[model samples]
Target chain A: MDNMEDNIKCVTCTAPVNIAVIKYWGKRDEELVLPVNSSVSVTLDQAQLRAKTTVMASPSFPNDRMWLNGKEQSMDSKRIQNLLNEIKQWRKEKHNGDTCTDGLLMWKVHICSENNFPTAAGLASSAAGYACLAYSLAKLYNVEGDLSAIARRGSGSACRSMYGGFVEWDMGSQEDGSDSVSRQIASENHWPELRVLLLVVSDQQKSMGSTEGMQATLKTSQLMDRRIQCVPESVEKIKEAILKKDFKTFAEITMKDSNQFHAVCLDSCPPIFYLTDVSKQIIQLVHAFNSSCGITKVAYTFDAGPNACLYLLEEDVGRVLSLICHFFPPDKDDLNTFVQGLQTPSISPLKVLLWT
Target chain B: MDNMEDNIKCVTCTAPVNIAVIKYWGKRDEELVLPVNSSVSVTLDQAQLRAKTTVMASPSFPNDRMWLNGKEQSMDSKRIQNLLNEIKQWRKEKHNGDTCTDGLLMWKVHICSENNFPTAAGLASSAAGYACLAYSLAKLYNVEGDLSAIARRGSGSACRSMYGGFVEWDMGSQEDGSDSVSRQIASENHWPELRVLLLVVSDQQKSMGSTEGMQATLKTSQLMDRRIQCVPESVEKIKEAILKKDFKTFAEITMKDSNQFHAVCLDSCPPIFYLTDVSKQIIQLVHAFNSSCGITKVAYTFDAGPNACLYLLEEDVGRVLSLICHFFPPDKDDLNTFVQGLQTPSISPLKVLLWT
Candidate 1:
């Protein structure tokens, strides 16, 4: 939807979700959404999980309005306000007298965003949502070049979703978070053998949002101090692993960092628990599965929820999926929609004794 | 029983369980069961949970034999063998000419032990068992003085169980762990206002024993290095809190240390999870209850198992217990034994909005 009307302008964009392999937890700068440490993320396929948004600017509107997944959501949040103001200001300054869309810059805007997947069950819906919002607004106002930094003002991890495939959020030294933008290290086509399986364990909204949870961890967890120092080195290692296509090294670091991130969550005062018994069982299954295979055939990373995001090679996907099906059989009625993602070659269910 | 018949002398002793608030997780010396850092523990009332051990020495006995819960247990474990050898050696050295008891030291011994509560479910059963064994054997051989250090050889936490109330296991600088003995900070009578409620959530034998679990955390968890440095200062703060009878400070430290210990477990590679959903729910309940009351009324700590050991003041015990019972109802058949500990003053359950 790129057509421009007489007094109103509209643009629609879609952004995919990304799971941080080396996570971004606590924030050094709250307003700017700057991270305490650099992080690495892998963008998921948009076909399975994404946020579709349409931004319309019109002289007829009174003020900024937002509608999320059909329901109207307040745009009064400081994060959202700052994001919209910053983008509009950037457009007004950068494209002062553009012939076609100049009048639309001063006009009020309405944002309608919807996620194909669940919203706040920690599937990184906000990342996709904010990235989509930023991308659409930028495109509508004729703002070109990298908008990752602008996208990050809405959500810290949102910046990573701005790029496809593997991305890195550099924890910039600037207090204003100018260098905290995420850039793609490799496109989706770089790793042809890589495959992912998104296991939707729970669709229920998370009890504590990431922002509040991060604050709790930062204040209460003494271990977080060490984690801050511990992350940068791993970011480099995972990057190297990503480029070399070293699945074993990548898998090892991914699982370790995810566990470490949650460990910090649990270490917080009034400890934040995002993982359920099913999440833990999935973890045990992965370890046992790897031990049984005599190699790291699969790796699992969880976000701020119980759902499990498994990454593995294409060849191993069949055997692993069969093992998963053998253990966690789909509900009788919802069997067709159970394993939703990029299609994997179907193989007969395998007998796996991988209980640890 | 304390009796001497024929050429046999027997002594029975009981020891109460202790829950470490500071936590004794990793060991600097595995063989000696020496901890990497100092810890503080509170001994629970023996009436609620205890291990009774009977040690007998007889010239007719061919070798040392042991029975646990009516089942014969091999004395092949190094910890048992080392404990027995050390005690006999000490007895032979100190009581060479103690006429009646002197001859008993030359004979082989038969040891039988049993715990009133579940074993290997993180109830500190091992602490009670080892303490009881050391006490009864010491009595049989007429070996006097503190057996806390000797008990430590069997299990690191056993040293703390030798005391009646609040105890501290100092992480002695000596490599031999000679100075790492536990001492009573305050007796059970010191805080008559203190009360405890033990929730036996799960008696399932833990997948990983504390010894092996500690090793894994020590090796893989980077945060553990920071935790080692962070604990000693809190140990001092908690000790001060205990001496001052400052429930708030003591409660805060107790809960923080418990969370940190479990956090390290989660941080480990192929992470270990001791707290179940029930345990986590209990944690949330405690926090919510404290917030609702505008004070820290209760503090909960978990060992390697999912069971919750809640510490609160005697005045607040009824309210807290009622809250616990409200959230967690007992099975019809097991209703009578649901809340087991020192008898609390019965009061009406107060209406509480503690679901956080």
Candidate 2:
């Protein structure tokens, strides 16, 4: 009653993470899912997506019970089941020398994930989720490997999630993907003045998932090869720019890379359009505003989603925020809510005001 | 005829033609206006633009009279006046060598041009109009030197109009542009079955002129170098494809080149958006229709404007026409008016329908 009943209770693990400045686009191997080029990312403070997971081994449970974000999902999917089975097998192999099981090992795993903001708001939730899942599971089961290596199996971008601050995923040449792992460049504390504003333009789910869309692009796009080859140089330059705190170079590279990524999406054989009219309008307005102000004060980046994440220097935060508010003026009733939400406590003491 | 009466009289010349498959985008030198790459084009049977010229050399005529299209344009503009003065000087030199000036330098030129379509339709009207004007004036006054060389002075692309069939503009490396000239690739009779459908999306003038836009892009765009360097290979491949009558390769190259050109436009520092929503929609619809049909039947190309030119194999012309008709159905009242204009003797037995 003691051991058997105690095993029925669930245990949980959780991890929080950030976004990549340099994007990861194509995969070298689909099975191992090694990327074709190295990528660099920055982990944000006071803004993150967390993934909480609980894994339990029970003698009485007939099958695995899994829940994601309070909703029960089918463990009937072979992929999830396979991963769970592998974790159990690793645990058993670690403690017991012989493989003799009277019944299938039963475990209940629950994941209650939440983001400070919206899920599909271009904040790289999947990157954080898969990275957290792989890291937490490996720790819980005592998996014999580096956390980054294990995370790579979950998602190519997940490898970069194992580290806390600036991380790089070096795309290795090994067939087994043993060399492909995330390496830390700088910690989050290194760049305290840097602030990112997640501008939620539209909360609609993306029309195309990154995985399927990227795979389609790789298969059919003539521009894919050129983009993959061209982006590495951009990544290298961005790394240097960040190290030197050259905001001008950093902003230029980030914008160019984003544009090039979207260009590849458009140049795909069937064409995948991730940018809406609103997104295009935002880009135009941002450039116009920058030129009008005679300063490169703010920089914007977008992922697979239509939302924009603007990065501003500490000195220019107030002005850029004001511009943003003026451009996206709130409705009469929502003016206060909008202004309160837009204020950046990290950079400015003065609060942002939104006119109805 | 008396010199006084001749001065009062006006002689006008008008010649209109159409553009072919080959496109000319960049120039090596602004002064000589040499192209950076060779291009091939086809001359259309149904000319849509014309150049009208009236020459009067009598003492009574003051200055150069030039009404471009319907408006009385400034011949005093340095560019226009310089060209006219050069032609006059060349005629005077020719007259000095001849005893009778009547056979040679009898006229000063006044030119008025109009397009049956719109000027900003991306139909290469300027190329044809300028070329025709140069050629007609040269013939009228018995000017010396090759007509191609003289036409090149009017407009870089105008040199190609000297021939009525398939023309290739050889982008020579010479500083003086002595070697840069348009050569005939194939006679009009070579591919008589080939046909092009011009779909006029918008007749509004482009925000940026082609020459200005190209210069801006060359100086500001990071992608410009890549485009200029990469396109030569594509151009070579397209030439081979066209020569071999390889529609698949030709279509692929054409689409890629057009996309790259547009990409370069977007990559410009200020960003030039020549494509409208309708243009993008047409591209997407055409691709979807072709892919769904499981055949590559029709290809579309865009110049500096939002208008599209659909190129189809002669065999698939009827099907493509029907598909276009289905998408843009003709109104009953307008259908009669359209058909009345289609009564030209050269009109094919194929029904003519306008796509709005």
Candidate 3:
């Protein structure tokens, strides 16, 4: 709500990160970030990894200002410009000038965003960052219609973070990308027993960004054609597995898709290597651990970076966690350091909320 | 030739190792070593990396005896038995006892094989080893017709080594493997300027043997099906490249095929990791070097080991070799010790030979 004295309207929203089970790799349309195949992801608990974004609109401000994690950044970037344009178009179409004053829609805005976790920790911060920005700004402007589509214009994977549950982004066939949007497949409450562990393999920035890597893959990878053809079947199977809470099938498919993604990277001309030696060792260790138990108790998947995100049932999480600690003891200096804000203190304040 | 007083007949032969440009990763029939797809290779110089074999047949010996690199090994292995049986059947069918003594044909045989380079250097010794054994025995028994076919029974890639210069192993469609044979694509002297440099990255034995690796790939790799379907096209293109003496296309196809083979390994369920960190570094360095040269002056390929075999024109070989020595300076201990047999002294005697 605006403070009438200053003519300042402000809104704050937090969005959690979403980890893809069926990965989104090559893009059909690079400009709109339209994926070659549909993808599904599990939205993580916002208490553990969330981006808190605040948007303030004021007619007195001369220009739009943005800050990310206390560092001021340019708002003239293409992605930011695209998101701002789409939201403004939506506001004009929905409100019909009924509740808006003249020049109010053209007011300059300030955006301040921060993340609880390390930005370079290989976590999907952009997904949460863009999602939070889109949601908070939409609330401040009274914009209507699909917010996920608005977020998709900013970052493709960010569209999935708009919902707290299992989400799927359909790689729509429309040329304008009007039909390409993310929707929640099921609520987070559907699989209450499922637990995800973030194995922070590194805190360094990736050598190849996802955008650059995907473009090279599309241009050079011979296997990309075959992978796109087979991914639709994988998406359907993973979605069904999530609905039924089938950990074994889900784990197998997740691991396979991760490996296939890396394989495609290797198949690229001059090749792109995202996984480090540690990432590879983690892969072997997970398989060995699962084999030791005589069943699939844990599954590991890696994104464009080396960090591994593992999925398991609540009953087996403790055992696997203990195994990880035993093998990879934490550094002595980091024993008392609170890196990730003490690990999601309680579940009470962790609910995913939609900004109104 | 036989000396009646000594009651012994002796034959000596040498075969060169073949470096696959298009690899053979899976088998349709494990027992017969029938490949799922055809493979093309360049048979290297025997003088540089060869397997030498000596076969002796004597009425005085009590039983079959074999020695590998001066150490005695068992002759009861399945592969050894298959090679012996195939040659015996060929001998009986072709010669028809016209010039053979009935008792001499049943004499006991002894085989001794040796290699100058490190057997554990990942140089595809088995290809040369079996090819030499098959050729030597065929000479000893006065057998005729398709010695490469007989070598195929010993080791699949060994069949390709039976020929000089460029070679291809046809993955026959017959269930009985009756038509599966290696054919010479070109003579060894076809491209005299072509040089292959063996960068022995490591002398360690591979953790997984090719037979075991291929079996795992066939059982688990999801991409293996697509790879097999597309390899016939690759085989044709590579053959064309070699015939046309188009070094750029040959290099591109070689590098691509190597990456695809490793990709299939990664796609395998439970996955097989054959390339080490050093191998990956070599790949990057090769690309960087080619980019710097503004052309594909050198190309590198790896088998199921970390060692890299690079193909370049004789003119560029010195530049690449100097580049390698500069980048990967040898340790003090290895300075005096000539590993991989002092790195191909000269191209004078280094010519692929066809066994007749």
For DockQ, the strongest prediction is: 1
> Poorest 10 consecutive residues of model 1 chain B by lDDT?
B347-356
Candidate number of the best TM-score: 1
Q: DockQ score of candidate 2? A: 0.26
Superior by DockQ: candidate 1 or candidate 2: 1
Pairs of residues clashing in candidate 2: B11-B54, B12-B53, B13-B53, B20-B42, B22-B40, B22-B41
Residue ranges of candidate 1 with Cα displaced over 4 Å: A95-102, A118-122, A347-356, B95-105, B118-122, B347-356
lDDT of 3 at A64: 95
- What's the true lDDT of residue A261 in model 3? 90
Docking class of 2: acceptable
Going through the candidates in order, their DockQ values are: 0.87, 0.26, 0.58
Pairs that collide in candidate 3 are none
**Candidate 3 runs further than 4 Å off:** A1-5, A96-102, A335-356, B1-5, B95-101, B337-356
Tens-digit lDDT string for candidate 3 (A69-102): 9999999989999998788877776766445444
lDDT ranking, best first: 1, 3, 2
Write down the DockQ of candidate 1.
0.87
Error of 2 at A260 (Å): 2.3
Estimate, for each residue in A64-179, the C-alpha lDDT of model 1 and write its tens digit.
89999999999898888888877877876786534436666778989999998756444668898889988998988877756888889999899999988899999999877778
List model 1 lDDT by residue over B1-356, tens digit each: 77997878989999988888999899999988889999999988777688999998899999989999889999998989878877777776785533536556668989999988657444658898999999888888777766988899898899899988899999899987789999988888888788777777777888899999999999999999999999999999999999999999999999999999999999999899999898999999999999999999899988888878788887787778777778887677665555444555563332211110
Task: Give interface RMSD, per candidate.
Answer: 0.5, 2.7, 1.1
TM-score winner between 2 and 3, please give it.
Answer: 3
